[model samples]
Target: MSDRKPINDAMDHMNGIEGYPTNVDLKSLPKPLRYFGYFFISFFVLFFITFFVLSMIL
Candidate 1:
């Protein structure tokens, strides 16, 4: 289609733009709390997976 050319040209122009920031400020929780959060989520996921598999098997 004739309309495709303008759209393609616009996309090509956007590809050359510099979008990354030179500096960033990062914040995070304490190490112990972060580890606890990770463990909690992992255990929750494993528990549900085990439950579903057992239900299907029985």
Candidate 2:
């Protein structure tokens, strides 16, 4: 029974998707890539403010 248990457990976890990764390790990315989240938020806020101010002036 022990021999079949491992095989059955693996089958149950399978989602049947093809050519896609099952997991990701973000820590493997470089330092700059990890800090992209902060830069993205800052850029979004700055763009929104600039657009709002321009519209108000016009």
Candidate 3:
């Protein structure tokens, strides 16, 4: 019968987490550079995990 979803309740639950940094200024960067940073960090994490696994296996 209600049209509005319970999004506020879910967000309130997330906000209660310990040590969670709530104030992120994503708009400070250009759109392209933001995506580039995401891609670079993702690649770095993946490469580190793969190298660690391979080293353990060999």
Model 3 lDDT per residue over 21-51, tens place: 4456987889899999999999999999999
Name the better of 2 and 3 by TM-score.
3
Which residue pairs collide in model 3, if any?
none
Q: Any residue pairs clashing in model 1, and if so which?
A: none
TM-score per prediction, in order, is 0.53, 0.44, 0.53
lDDT of 3: 0.76
Superposed on all Cα atoms, the candidates' RMSDs to the truth, in angstroms, are 10.1, 7.4, 8.2
Q: List model 1 lDDT by residue over 1-58, tens digit each.
A: 1223325866746644633333444336678877888899999999999999999999
Instruction: Tell me the TM-score of model 2.
Output: 0.44
User: After superposition, which runs of candidate 3 have C-alpha atoms over 4 Å from their true positions?
Assistant: 1-26
How many Å off is the CA of 49 in candidate 3?
A: 0.2
lDDT for 44 (candidate 1): 97
